[model samples]
Target: MRPAPSDLEPVSRTAPADGTARAGRSLPRVAAALVLVLLLLVIARLPWAGDLGMHAATVQRLRHSLLDPGNPLVDADTPSPYYSPWTLVLGVLARLTGLSVFVVLRIGALVGLGLLVTGVLRYVRTLSSHRAAPALALLCLLLLWGPLLFAWSGFLGLNSLALTVSYPSVFALGLGFHFWAWLTRAVRGTAAWGTWVALGVLWALILLCHQFTGVVASLGAAAAVLAARPARAVLPRLGAALASGLLVLWLWPYYDFFALFSAGADLEAIHRPLYEHLAARFGLVLLGVVALACRARRDRRDPLVLFFVLGVLVFAAGGLTGHYSWGRALPAALIPAQLAAALETVSAGRRAVRAGWACVLGAALAVGAWTQAGTLGYVVPRDRLPAAVAAKYRTPWAGYQWITRAGVRYGDVVMARTFPARQIPAYGPYTVAPGYPDVFLPDADRRAAAVTRYFGGSAAQRRGIVREYGVRWVVGPESLAGPGLRKVTAGPGGQVLYRVVP
Candidate 1:
């Protein structure tokens, strides 16, 4: 199945006819392209916070020293994989910039997007000599940005990066791809010892940012090995890359790599039709798959083809398992690989066919841009808190404003309807009863159930919830403010805050 070395040479080297273009004009074009990418990312991110509440709560706790040194997540303090070092970086940036964490996150996301573009370009340069290949690839990625699957998955490593600032997986994906470009060079004996060390540090950083992204990177590297073939030439370098990745696990012994697999098993019982489950991104995905097949047929040794194959596997894994995150890694690899294939197809085609394909790709990109704009329109369109966040805690508007004015302190337990229980902790320092939102916690479900009963059940059940959960205060609409509770505050909407009697 291996193509002759001559067929592979064009992929690895610039065509002689374009050597002058590569030498004289490439730098200017590349610089211009990067600037364009950065600007687009900035514009796309003007509206922020897709799911800002949970992550904001975590950052708030850490930044304000509300968290115990040992605990990172606010209500659920137990050690888990979600405590991200990148979150700390964002917190520190907020401190230094004197900006809202939201603003800092937007800037940080833009930087991550830029790095991702650079990584894609480097990776594409390794597999194709076409000067416009990198630009075309990035444009395609941006055009795909606003589609539901890509946006929810963090804009497929484009300008609309990260579903929210709190989740660093999207940013980590960018770093992971950048790391892959370096690893490929190392594996091919083209990178220096320093480059290998840098890549190792990069791997460690990705693990700290999000463990799942690290897993995705490892899979991509495996795909690269398959594309390289003839193990002897690349084995030593591949070993170096593998060793670098493994070194991180050794250093971070607390990392429970198997933990998420078990946790994700919970999703297996829930099923949806493949198209609906994939958010209707299947058509674009099919096009990518077909393009990759064509690229492979042209040259089986084309590394781009293998990379796209791995992307499809990741996308399919998510669909099959009902785990959206499993396929979240698709954008980083798929965007560049698909673009390269498209460019190659256009270059190899007859005049009429080439123009038709170009127009099709161009139109797809335009549609994606419009989709991105509309999607972001829904993200942070207004200055006020989102209705989703507002509805999380159905406190009357006046009652919640009163709590905010009263300065709800850290660790203050408030008993209320536990529907969307993350609200109080997310918006204020006060802890809520049934604090455990952890999937891994053995008592989480029971606690949630008990809290639910307290809100709607008889007075006897309310007392049991208070006694069991150490209820300090009860907050709700006035009608539920029964006996043995001292109403400390009242609101125009008939909401009340009552202190639970001893």
Candidate 2:
């Protein structure tokens, strides 16, 4: 089923590896993970958003089982899942050991992120199926870790932002979908891939544990389903994808709100004559269509191609419409499209093919090489930690692991945006907090006031709003813990208790 790699032909895969080199190759991946892991660990100290630090801390507590497991996500503020179960799991493991919960949380977030990057790399290699896939995979992983990480480093918005649309969580969802797809297949008396089922269960457990990932994962399963199967199986797989998607959407309350809220937006915004947007949105894809026209004559039914098509369609529609952050969603399709391009580059026999491959290859190499450098002079790579803080990470409970000869709750029922609060609630049975991305944590009236304060107004208006929100001590990640708010005793992340001045 694997394609062969081509230096000239447009369609090729790597030759099947024999045991020795295959086994030996593991070292490079290990080395890559180690490199990224260490860098991410160092980045953690440089002020990861206060919230990301908190999430790390929460992961620490969960690993220790310092709290009950069932509490939902944190902070209803700013529209996304704050909890990341995969990161939390690693934190839990660290808590079990003697490592600082802060270290554990930071390390775990980086490790999970690194592992997700590895998964993308392996997926790229497998999808490319080439000797060069390994090289390309590493390069792409490096791009993500290096430039992307650097660009998003301290800014820590949703995409690279800890709770904001973390793409790795989507990676988890893809893993979960693959699992459930196999489970369904097995139940149907078709070949069952227990491996997928195991993966699904593990991620589902993680999703249950944290909400941020759960949201992205929920939507990403449909895209991953195609990756797990070939054409003849597309119908069944699509159906499976649809069912899984529906299930995921139903479980979380946010989707409905997002959908509803988006619907409420000026219908004019949603209804922009489809043509104006689609043309701009799918300009690249239309070019791909030209490529497809050239390739279709040769007879192709490639999974990566399918991914490209679906991704293009979704990206175009999203950009054209007001659907959930289309740019972030674009990556699901981008991965496959990029891999297909990489594979085809080597596959084509033309001398020009090598030139084209060289460009892509060079870019990927740069991603790997400069992942840690923060350059305002340079745009940060996607995978590396960011050099600037667009917003400080906040989640109070994530910091300060309780050193209990025996465990005790401090009798504080603090509410937070999402992740750390989710983790913290479990720590103290008496503590109450938002279930997930809670609206209540940040006062609704205040958010309204904040909007008036920050939006569609003069600079003076924005400052007033910022000050007003800060004064209430109710807003999140932004104004909640600023200058007007005084810090009390701190946790590992400087998890501070800011009192609204009387």
Candidate 3:
């Protein structure tokens, strides 16, 4: 009654009906990959590029670092940059490949997403109940999860990193990382060569990319592998993986978190409404129950159920704090739910049963594809960029460029806020008063005051800034009717340039 990929049989529903030969096997695979890739690129290339701007900023800095070494050109300071190094390589690699920023982002989106789907599909074939694992895990996940992730990832740059976290949870709960590592080591013929070293480096790089998630993934993988090995072998395997983690930890101090190192994947996000978390766990349990019921009563040998059950209990208990705390625990829920869905397929009774599950899974996949490829993706992103207005103020990047072109010397202690300092491009060798989020880390109120005093001040206040910031020239986008602005440029997002005439 064991349903495994090694024993996969074609579904009986559409089996060579009426003696018509099955469609060309080779074609569908290629077609599926191409359609998905092209569609993903389109969604990623749109003007908004979603939250990609934030990541682009991050990658921009990392890219500049490679060339300047002394001064990486990334926007300084961000809120949550705990694990940016791991993914930055892709950005660096994209620049080297000579693609535009848009194309490079699209490339990472395609590659990362493509690999994610691959992992799902492969697991689906494991046939727990014919529901979940690599092939994209059960069809419902394929349907709903794909569309949700595709649509969200296309619309949110931060979501890309979120997916980076979610993908490894699949591996942690599905294939078992420790098993893969052990296999890598066991194959001395393979391991003796540089393959081991390369894997080590690759693993380390991934850890660097999204340190928190990467560490969680590594721990989950190592644990899964350890569980599968002999009692004696478990200790050795555990030691090796831990050592690898330790080596990286030595380089980056934050890797020392025990929960992250222990049950790290469990807390991957900060989703709220604690009740929702409970509901999700309950749903997975329900699905797990139904999937296990399809198997022979004696087949309780499947530890997949227990894996999911324990995960549910632990995560629900942990969710109480995940909202208030740094949500590093959400990944735990994703694994069990995926397994329950994908593994459900193996219990198919006849043609109808298999067809039923496939239809469900197929619908999920279709919606995912449609969401990424749909016309809805072409318009403004979920978060409106306040454009036409955004266009008026010279971006901070552009403003700095303006000063260089004019050969003007901006004084020390200029104020900085994304909107207020939109005109301030790259400023060098000068400290600003109210500064970029990277440097000053001020709250919105302080930022607002600085903007009010510098760009939006009354004519008298503008005159007073000479005493405030020690600079005579003030140039930025301030609302025309606002207190102290003389219009430099106007549209929706207007520009104001003033010189304090004290």
> lDDT winner among the candidates?
1
Give the residue spans of candidate 2 off by over 4 A: 1-47, 50-54, 57-99, 110-114, 141-190, 193-300, 359-372, 375-502
Per-residue CA lDDT of model 3 for 34-144, tens digit only, reads 544444544454333223344443344444444332111122232333223433554477557765544555556555555545544543443332222343342333233
Q: What tens digits encode model 1's per-residue C-alpha lDDT throughout 1-502?
A: 9999999898667675367445433543564475465455444554333344445555555566523422332344555454466776776665566676556656666766667768878876666676666776656555543244433434453334434423576578778768777767666656665566667667777877776567667666666667666347445655665587667655653235446567765433332322253434524444445666677788786666666667667767777666755655555355545565456534646756655666666566555554444333333433354454333221211114365455455565677665324455554444444343444555566766776787789988888777766667777878887766887887444667788775
Winner by TM-score: 1
TM-score of 2: 0.52
Single out the weakest 10-residue window by summed lDDT for candidate 2: 150-159
Winner by lDDT between candidate 3 and candidate 2: 2
- TM-scores for all predictions: 0.73, 0.52, 0.58
Candidate scoring better on TM-score of 1 and 3: 1
RMSD of 3: 9.7
**How accurate locally, in lDDT, is each candidate?**
0.57, 0.41, 0.40
lDDT of 3 at 103: 58
Please tell me which model should have the higher TM-score, number 1 or number 2: 1
Task: Give the poorly placed runs of model 3, Cα more than 4 Å off.
Answer: 1-35, 43-50, 67-83, 87-91, 94-100, 121-142, 145-204, 215-223, 226-229, 252-289, 292-314, 322-328, 346-352, 359-376, 379-502
